[model samples]
Structure formats: structure tokens, C-alpha cells
Target: MSAVTPLLAAEELSFAYGPGQPVLREVSLAVAPGESLGLVGESGAGKTSLLRLLLGLSAPTGGRVVFEGHALDRRSAATMRKFRQAVQPVYQDPFSSLDPRMTVGESIAEPLRSLRVTGDRAARAARVAELLTAVDLPADAATRYPDAFSGGQRQRIAIARALAPKPRLILADEPLSALDTSVRMHVIELFQRLAREQGIGMLLVSHDLTIVSALCGRMAVLESGRIVEEGPTGQLLTEPQHPYTRRLLASVPRLPG
Candidate 1:
């Protein structure tokens, strides 16, 4: 873990809307190669805002975002395109993230077409099927429209779309929060498998400590846009230093004795 370089990094990131309401201030974190770093916090703790800033979708008020040791900017069009392809984001609301007008297959293929990845439509369709199978979904799913799928299925489709570009870094913002327990377990397992097998670095933004503990090697707890505590998952869960961390953990339901 100490040997590899970071796949994604942010230094002293600050962002805000209008003149007031600063969402993030000096928030810094790094995700190592092929590693999973969970970002957990209560709602409005600036989790989603930070992700947008990292992806270059929203400019930081005052800080830099670096990916694969390269600062993210449009200085070179080709370089910026490569950075876009390298980093992909999966939003929490699949229903909204996906284009309702497009079929499942079309939605998945959009990335390849937009990126000009240089592949025939037939070949891309075939690859999409393979990805669906990898995610434990049916091939026929690609033929259906997004409206036909359930919440879990929609999330699966969204994940498949993100994987189409073969991104090195994936930022999943609460990808499994909407699903039932059974479906959430399946999605979490899929995420873990992808991290291990595909060598993909994932920045999973979630408020669920149990989910983070299951998937992330290390994590940071955010409070009012500040990382109050951060360490190995096991260490922090067993013995957290910050009061907010302990309070967050206590909020999770526990079984009877």
C-alpha cells in the first residue's frame, strides 16, 4: 500500500456557491492505486460538493485537483480528455443520472461514442453484455429501457455505464443507499470485486459506516466539511478518537445480545 503512487489527490480544496456558503475548505485526501477510500459524513457535510470539485465538474474556489500525478485542467485538450476518461462518477440517483429517453444499451454505449473510443457499435454492444454479466445482470437488460428496471437494477445499469470507459478512478456517491438490504449487499460485493480484480481506485462517498468498513481499507469521517478523524477501517471502528466519529458509529443499529 505504501509503495504505489496516488491515483487521485486534492490539496487544500475550497469551494463555495455565490459569495457566501463555503461548502469545502482545505479538504485534502488521496486515493492510492487500486485502493478504496471511503468518505463518510452526515448529509450536507460537503461530501457531494467535494466529489464535484475533484471531478472538475465544479471548479474549486481555491485549490487544485490532481489525478495520476497530473493537475486536472484544460491546458491541453487531449490531456483533459484523457483525465475525463480516467475518472468516472456514479451518482446516487440512477433514475436521474440515466437518460430516460435512451435504452439501457444506448445509455451504456454513450461513453464510448462520446469519447470516440474507436469501436464498432456491434463490438461495443457485445462488451456491454459482458459487463452486465460481470455485474451479475442479464444480457437482455441492455435491450430494455431504464424505466423498466427497479431501483437496484437501475443502479446496476449506472455502474455498467461507468465501467464502459474502463476508468482508473471511480467516484461513487451513495450508489447503494436507495436499494434494499439484499440488493445493497450485492452491489457492495460487486464494488469490492471490481476494486480487487480490475485494479480500479474507488472513492466511495457514503454515510454508512458498516458499508464503509466492509469495503474500504482506510476512511475519513467528515464533519462540517472537515475530516475530523481518519485511519484504518478496523482501527477507527474499534477505537475512534473524534467524538463525531463515535457518534456516527453509535447511530448505526446493532443486534441484540
Candidate 2:
């Protein structure tokens, strides 16, 4: 079998703002088809900055982002359009991520409109219903507004929206942080199921080690914009090498011996 090209990759990426010190220095990572990677770090570790660079929201001062073997060239509208179509993002705050005025169905279908997907009104509505069902939301939920649902339900809507584009890869930033602790695991499970069933790759960014360990097979630990350690989730959690990585693992509470 031929080697499967990576869905997304950041090669020796470096980014900085103004004249300040670089936020990300020589950082690199890759997300392959059907792969899920967890990006973990404390605040100010430059995780967000790195995500933006990967998403092509901002160009890096050095290095490059490659998607599907092609270097991202925002200068070309075609490159950007194709990149946007292939990559989707799910933000942490579902409520804010969703438009208040647009109905849930409209919000989910917005991507279809942006991508100029072909379909009549009825067909689009049917697609919206299908997506809602996929996320375990009732079809009628689509007629309601974002405020009509609980935090968890709103997040489900967000995930449905991310899935709308039929993206090759999903970049989720702190997806469960804004959710209730009880609902976090449920959402994480939903992510895993959706990614697996859809055969889509995921880059999940979060500080919760337990959640990452549960949801992702592989993980990368970031400290001050650099990847300090990376490996299979199980090995990294049990036997981390870097002091920063060990400290992160230490923060996770454990049962009495």
C-alpha cells in the first residue's frame, strides 16, 4: 500500500509578535488521516499561537505549514479556499462560537453556504437534520436558538457545525473546558466516536491530561512554545522524560496506593 499523506503538518514552525520574543520556536507536529493528537500545556505555553499557525490564520515568521503535501500559500485565494474547506475548527465556547440570532440549523448549514455546496433549500435542510441526528440532537433542536440548549447541547451543535464541512481534519481548541465537568467526558466520547466513525483526523488542544489521555492515542507536551516531549499517550503519562512533562503528569490526581 502507498504511504498515506499527512492531513496536516507544521514543519519546524516559528512565530513571533512585533519585536517580542518568539511565541513558538522550532515547534513541529503532524496529524495523519484518522489520527488524533492531544496538545497539552499550561497557559502562556503558546499552544494557541501554534494552533493559529497550523490553521493558517497567521503566517509564521519561519518554517511552514503543509496540508495534504502542499505548502499553505495564503497569497493564493484558491489555496486558502481549499485549505478552509479541508480544515475545520471547533472552539471552546460553544455559545460564543454560535451566532445568537441564527437558528441552530442555520448555524450548522452556514458552512455549506460558505463552501458553496450544491443543494436546494430542502436538500440543505435534510442535510442539517442528518447532521443533528449524527450528533444525537433531535431534529427539532435545529429550529431553536443557541440559548435554548444547555452548555453541553450547545457544544454538540458546535461539533455538528464542524462536521458540516466534511472536513478532513478537525482542530478543536479546549473543547471541554467550558462545559460542565460531568458533561466533559460525554463530549470527549462523542468526539472519539465521531472521528472514528467519520474517519477524520483530530488535533485536540487542552490542558486536562486525563481527558487527553482518554481521547487521544498520541500526545505532545508543549512548554514555552517548544515541544518538550511526545509519545504514545499511555507511555507519556506513565513515564514522561522532561521535567515539564513530569510536572504536568504530576498535577493529575490519582487514587491512593
Best by TM-score: 2
| Candidate 2 lDDT | 0.90
lDDT of 2 by residue, 1-257 (tens): 99888889999999999678889999989999889899999999998898999988998999999999988998998788788878999888987999999999999999888777735778789889999999899999989999999999999999899888788889989999998889987887888888778988889999999889888899999999999999999999888899999898788888999
Clashing pairs in 2: none
Against the true structure, what is each candidate's TM-score?
0.95, 0.96
| Number of the predicted model whose lDDT against the real structure is largest | 2
Q: In terms of TM-score, how similar is model 1 to the real structure?
A: 0.95
Q: What is the lDDT of residue 254 in candidate 1?
A: 93
lDDT of 2 at 118: 34
Score candidate 2 by TM-score against the native. 0.96
Give per-residue CA lDDT, model 1, range 1-257, as digits (tens): 55666888988899888687888878889998778899999999999999998888888888798887878875677876788788889999877989989989899889888877736988899878988987888898888898998888899889998899889989999988888999899888998899888999889999998899988999988888888888898999999999999999899999999
Worst lDDT window (10 residues) for model 1? 1-10
User: Where does candidate 1 stray beyond 4 Å?
Assistant: 1-3
